[model samples]
Target: MSKLLEVKDLAIYFDTYQAEVQAVRGVSFELDEKETLAIVGESGSGKSVTAQSLMRLTPMPPGKFAGGSILFNGEDLTKKSESQMESIRGKDISMIFQDPMTSLNPTMTIGKQIAEGLIKHQNMSKKEAHNRGVELLKLVGIPNPEKRINQYPHEYSGGMRQRAMIAIALACNPKVLIADEPTTALDVTIQAQILDLMRDLQQKTGTAIILITHDLGVVANAASRVAVMYGGKIVETGNVDEIFYNPKHPYTWGLLSSMPKINNGEEELQAIPGSPPDLADPPKGCPFVARCPYAMKLCENHMPEYTNLSDTQKTACWLLDERAPEVEPPESAIVGGAKVHG
Candidate 1:
């Protein structure tokens, strides 16, 4: 696998009447060809903002790139003008938004929506694009594609609409696909079907994916790597196994402890105490310090550097310091009945 996209020290901010809100602060990650990277976090943790930044989708004036570079296929996207970005947006890279209902244009027929990109990027004739649209619809598991292609978005079911969105995003055979909460709107069975469809499509098309969601279960099912974001920064990153089985950050522990366990009968899920930090008047030190049960005085005033736990695992926390007291992860953080020693 080769590196297809690289985001270095990316910082996204929103300018408002009150103050500048740091939506994404010094966030960095990479996506390799034919790989799936999951960015997992709660709402307002900057997961969607970070994903949007890759395509330069965040609106300016209110939203601005405060710092850092987004390099796609060796070209710096941050340096590209809107005209230049237009050339790359749907052809080289594409995105599947959270809600197909809101993202899809209501007036256009399903086939026309899918054909728009093909016509724009591939320079296909309307007839050519329409034919490709039917194939794309069929490829994504939509039945009666010939007839369904002529129907409006409102005519399709929720899952079918999402599949249509996928067909549109994948129409150009993009090298990278950014799926922001692709299954968040569907029921459990439909969610599973969507996930399976995405995996199958990846296998067939060889498109690298960046899946953004709050669900750790989805991450476990689809991603090979995980980046845990909180308070506008990536607190921890590792392979799926390391993140789920041997998480290092206190924030990561809190997230894991909150997950529902089937075997732990009668056990209540533990919620992380306190709200996330105010980004407008953001915390000077570690954002998790306010909610961390093991926070030290140092954590209140200073940020910690990322401690490398393995070739692929790293976390930023004062607890990993040699001088700081060693603490064990709470029993509730244990998954699959295995305890992680700190």
Candidate 2:
């Protein structure tokens, strides 16, 4: 797989009256063409911030791009002016948010909403844009695209609105799609439908995808690879199978154990013991050490560098360091963890 998108040393910070919050630390990763990369982390772990940073859409005064480069299709988006980014957005990269209502204009007809992108980015004529919007709606599996396009967002159900959003995103056949918790509020059936649509469209368009969510089950079914983020950094990363079955990072282990199981005899789902570290004044050592079950003295005193398990699998944990004493990850994480490591 060749690299299609490379994010090098990306940092995003927010300024406030109290202090500055570094939402995205020096994070780096590469995504390949037609590949699905899932970024999993807790709610405030910089997952959404990183996704938003890709389009240079974050508010400047409140949210600033402190440093680094986002290389998309051999060009650095970070260096591009807003106008340049405007040309790139919707054509080169498009994003879908968690709430369709907020992203979609309530006042505009769905047809016009989808058509706007077609005309702006694809340079289709008014008549041509209208025709293409109908086609896109049909492609995303919405029923009666011709008539439905005339309706407002409120007229459509949650699932239908999400489908409409997907139709709008596919308007220009972008090279990359960033879906930030796209299935958050939808039901199981709707979530499955959306995931299927994304996968099917990805096959047809050959677009790379970045799926941001905390659901490990979603990653198992959809993503080709997974990057486990914590405290504004990637704690573990590997192919889908490797990350799931052979996870080495303690943070990944906690995540796996915390997932709700079916037909299990447990009284209640087990939760991770501690809260996430403070990003404002983050710990000097491993950010997860305060919460890690297997933490050691070295873990508290120093941070770990990225340890290479294979060409495709790497993690930032002292457990994988050659100098540290070897220890096996919990058996519970083995199913998913070993899939990556083995």
Candidate 3:
């Protein structure tokens, strides 16, 4: 349960002809050994960008690290040179990108793609790497590993291709594995299988994981802790139970209310109103103030400080202030048909 990775006040910006877009603003979180931390948010909330920054995958010139430090294994990754990062990228921390179809090289054999890291980092011979590739394929539940290894990515099914990506990311037995939307675009059955596989792999390998996704179901199924991101910032974070059952932030309430409930017959999903803020000209006050139902005048001009609710749960909202009016969460925000009192 030792701390393996810590991102402190991390900020990432993208330059454009018009303005500098703050893709991530003072975002922070930590990962423990052999744990799964889910970063859940809608698209463009900076979940992927934050995950990419861990490996220095965000392209420079267009993307730049504006501030903060990424501490992994007691070293600062933001300060590492590209050459230095190269040594740590696949071997120490690895990533399973969103799309296996596009991430995997079309021309290379599946075995060779898996072997590339083994050959580069482990210094294994081509023959040895190929054997390990087969083992990895088999480990990920791909049938006929011996034959599948020699086939191209186009030859495999979508789920199999995703499994291959996981195999590649896990090949080096990395300390931290960042799976950015690993189950994206897959059917429910396949998504379940992938989630099970990831959990099994984490237990077997003792590798910490950072799962980035917009699906609350996926977060509930896989993660122990959750960080709810919105408008390029983490508005609330806590253990899974606290986030799902006792969420404090209005943004978190909106997310929960939107989740489909099987028992709530004929009930419509409560979608959060308004579009997310534009990062290029983000609100000077609370990023969510425009959409929050209980927004005060103070929320329009100043960001609220985070209020610690428990040892593990914290949220940023004017509603949590001692002087602010008390407001109950909308009935739709209830997790299991049980009301959550503020």
Give the winner by lDDT.
3
The Cα local distance difference test for each model comes to: 0.92, 0.86, 0.93
lDDT, model 3, position 269: 71
Question: Model 3 compared with the native: what TM-score?
Answer: 0.97
> How are the candidates ranked when ordered by lDDT, highest leading?
3, 1, 2
Q: What TM-score does model 2 achieve against the real structure?
A: 0.95
lDDT of 3: 0.93
- Comparing candidate 1 with candidate 2, which one achieves the higher TM-score? 1
lDDT of 2 at 105: 93
Candidate 3, residue 316: how far the Cα is off, in Å: 0.9
Which 10 residues in a row give candidate 2 its minimum summed lDDT?
333-342
Q: Write the per-residue lDDT of candidate 2 for residues 1-342, one digit (tens) a residue.
A: 678899998999999888898888878999999999999999888999999899988888799888999998778998999999999888889999998767789899999988888889878998999889889889999889889989999999998888898888778988899999989878999998899889999999998899999888778778998999998888899998778777889999889877766545454777788798878777778889999888889988787999899988999999887777788766555452223321
Candidate with the larger lDDT of 2 and 3? 3
How much is the lDDT of residue 243 in candidate 3?
Answer: 93
